[model samples]
Target: MVLDFGFLKTEMMGEIDACCDHGMMIWVDDPWIASFLPFTSREASAEVMQQYRAEVRETGQKLIEGPFGKTLLLSQVPTAENLAKHWFRRLAPRVRLRSGNRADLLSVVVWETPNCMATYHAPDLGRSRPGLSPRHSHSEKFPNEIGGIAGEGGNLGSHERSTFSQRF
Candidate 1:
């Protein structure tokens, strides 16, 4: 998985103490591309692949130069959960469009640390299903800790360390 980390600047440190108290960072993963590497070379065009890579790199650059540098201030809380959802929303449509709806973005997980992370699922894309696999089953084990937000489940377990996940 190609994990992209974005450093965001936020002023709301007093409310919820983020893992990165000094500087907040969000991790985004492209698991679909990693999973289908063999098939991607044959099925996907070189231009499409280059464009995807460029876009991902450009996004990280913008976030670093803009938000991380305090040149562009975000209105949101900039928490792990919120950032995960925000990135998921931003990238999902683009992924669908670029891949011609062939790619399935299961979830976007913003990591505050190796142990703590927040995941956002795409409900409309038919990717957010309950009790689908072992990963989903973990939420059931810690329902009280793993709070449900807008049909997307959150895992607060320390053992369940994952930056992002896909169905495959």
Candidate 2:
């Protein structure tokens, strides 16, 4: 699983763990972007964060062309000076992919819909939400399940907070 990120907040660790719970392996794309935030102000980070988030997302789609074998996460892409407009439009069609222009921070979770194709494909998947393998049943949990949550979205507590680059 590849988790793309933007100046994501410390609060989102729960979501990540829950997804991992569903038998998914998180890749965590663009971790470097978040790692850079502490040295600068929030305003400065948003521009850099947006551009990187978009770039990472586009990269994720190109690789998901084959059958589903692993849990994937594509974090928020930064759309700075040269945003990947064409690729962005290509991958995300069914979901509303928005970002925080102000850099307040962000998190991920899924809302189930009866006819929602995304859930069928990568139920609870964020970013690409790629189509699922035909052999797998809907009842199967992503390998990274934690209690009831799946696909890296788990019940996060203080121990996890250290992994997050806390923002002021």
Candidate 3:
């Protein structure tokens, strides 16, 4: 799988807006133009804050300012300079092609979609191991499955156990 970023920028800023609407962590890379309140002035007076907000709306920029002076983050999609900077003349991957005596090699590909990232890895090259294979083996107790909250009816507290038992 391969993801092409070229098509994303042409949309109606929908991709960026969707990311923002979901409250996802957005970190603008270098060269993206954004205005950040200085550390000493992050907690501006109410009047100043209102002015800043007005300016942001007028310029179509986003502001990330918290109550504290130290926590201020500003991010905006870069257009002219940054876009030019991001351009790459050529993108080439080094791949080894089997010509003569070389054995077949496996390949892995990754694609980034709007909802999630997809990763595909070719099966092993006929090598067997004693332990489980990472590609096909998965534990129910993965990192994201904290407190036993994994599959349905998993890790329910004792209070709910009776209700779950009745349904089963």
For every candidate in turn, the CA RMSD to the true structure comes to 17.1, 19.2, 19.8
Backbone steric clashes in candidate 2, count = 50
Q: Which stretches of candidate 2 lie over 4 Å from their true place?
A: 1-39, 60-119, 122-168
Q: What TM-score should be assigned to candidate 3?
A: 0.19
Candidates 2 and 3 compared: the better one by lDDT is 2
- The best candidate in terms of TM-score: 1
lDDT of 3 by residue, 41-133 (tens): 435544565664566445433445433222222233333222112111000011111112111112221113334322222234225212213
Which residue pairs come into collision in candidate 3? none
Error of 1 at 121 (Å): 1.1
Per-residue lDDT for 72-153 in model 2, tens only? 3344342321112222233223112322221111112132233221222223333322322223322233322111111211
lDDT of 3: 0.26
Cα RMSD (Å) between model 2 and the true structure? 19.2
Indicate the residue-level lDDT of 150 in model 1: 19
Clash tally for model 3:
0
Pick the winner on lDDT between candidates 1 and 2. Answer: 1
